[model samples]
Target: MSQKVREIRLDQIEANPNQPRKLFDETKIADLAASIKANGLMQPITVRPLPRKVGEQGRYMIVAGERRFRAHKHMGAETIRCLAVEMTEDEMAVKAIIENLQRADVTAMEEARAFQSMLDRGYTVAALMKELGLKSRNRVLDRVNLLRLNPEFQTLVEGGNLPPAYACEIATLPAALQVKVIRQVSTGQLKTAEQVRHAVIALREALAQDDIFAAMPAATEKEVAVVNRMEAKVEQIAALAALGFKDNECTIAKKVDPNKVKGMADKLALIRNHLLQMEHALRAAAAQGEILAA
Candidate 1:
């Protein structure tokens, strides 16, 4: 239920533990505090009543507008404006995440962390896209993946020192690779986002070329053709055998050929051996591909 906006003591209000935002820019808060001092607070922050403790009576936990709360606190305003609302934990978390994501100053890393919190609570990507008004599943996935970024890169992105888009591009890479690329950006060796993109591409391609599997001999065009023909041959033989194995029309005794059975067993063993070898080679190739892409 909604309660009327009222004046609340700054000391009585508490920051929400579930608040999505972790970092608040001091300069922005100072500017906001100055604005509040000059124009007065234009909007009342949302809060929920906290259970009165022995000495901490009449306190409230912020449900939204934490930035405003901080700003008001900064200005040493004894009494501030607030609207009290009752909300469940999930509701409060959603509101906090939405409020922060909608704000211009919230960093990409913060947004990503908020999205991840919901996901950890069992929310699906499709549900998050709908709730957050994101246009695509891929976009939501991108935001969630940002949480996987290297801690140092996340700090740079959070501090507004690194371009978010470039950080996201490297977030797809392994953590070691991300640190290496970000170090180049930090050193100003890679001046522009475009330069970073080109460098990443060149690095990935170089890694791919150096892959051990890439050095391994691949199937020749003729070998590929031969493999296809062999598959067809096996299919034809299987079909023929199925036709003869009719439940009512054939019996093992009637169809028995001891020599042919022995021949078939030998061939199956050879096939299994060939398959094992192929599987090993394919596994090596897959591992190499992952490393290059990483």
Candidate 2:
């Protein structure tokens, strides 16, 4: 429910214990204070009234615009403008999450943790989409999966020092290897998403080989041939895919229209169909327990 805008004592408003954004940038708060001080408060902060003690007056907790509230405090303002909303704790939690998720500056890890908290409260993916105005379930799930990365790596992601592609590949490595790979990333030794992905695959293959030699039974000649063939296929596909990606940027992407190359789209479509078939075949083999490593 909504209430009219009113002036409230800065001291009377409390921070929401369930606020989704745990971290705040002090520099941004100072900037906001400067902006508010110069331009006057352009928008009133949103707040929810908390349960009051016996014979006490109304007390408020921020539901959104925490930075604005802090900005007001920083300027030593005694009272600030607010919209006093009435809501249950659950409603406040959901509202706070939606508000923060809508912000452009929300970090990937912050979004991940927020979505996880919603999932912890039994929110279905569909429900989360409706509540958060997201179009795809995969978007929410992807953010939540970022929590699986080591916190240090997640910090790099959150701080915008690491690209999401590199982080995804790093997440596939063992925790010990993840640290080393992250150092490579920080030191600029591992540049580009493709390099990181290739490094991850190389490490994974090495580990698989180690496991096979340490514990697995000896491979027959036919099994060895199959493994070699599979590796060759992967390398071929990876090389072709990399070429295709780079070509895309220089071909039609450069604003050059070539009706000269007839059936270009058709050729790509044929390749896509073949790729889909290969994927289905691999999945079917795995379902039948036939694709285990040596």
Top candidate, metric TM-score: 2
Q: Candidate 1: minimum summed lDDT over ten consecutive residues — where?
A: 285-294
Q: Tell how far residue 259 is off in model 1, in angstroms.
A: 50
**Candidate 2 versus the native: TM-score?**
0.67
Clashing pairs in 2: none
TM-score of every prediction relative to native: 0.64, 0.67
Clashing pairs in 1: none
lDDT of 1: 0.80
lDDT tens per residue, model 1, 1-294: 667799999998889876778888789999999999999899999998877768756989998888898998898889889998887777777888888878877778777888888888888888887788888786667777777787877887888888877876777776767776787787787888787776667666556655755788998999999999988987896686677666656455366687687776688789789878977876765654553454
Provide the overall lDDT of each model, using Cα atoms, as 2-decimal numbers.
Answer: 0.80, 0.80
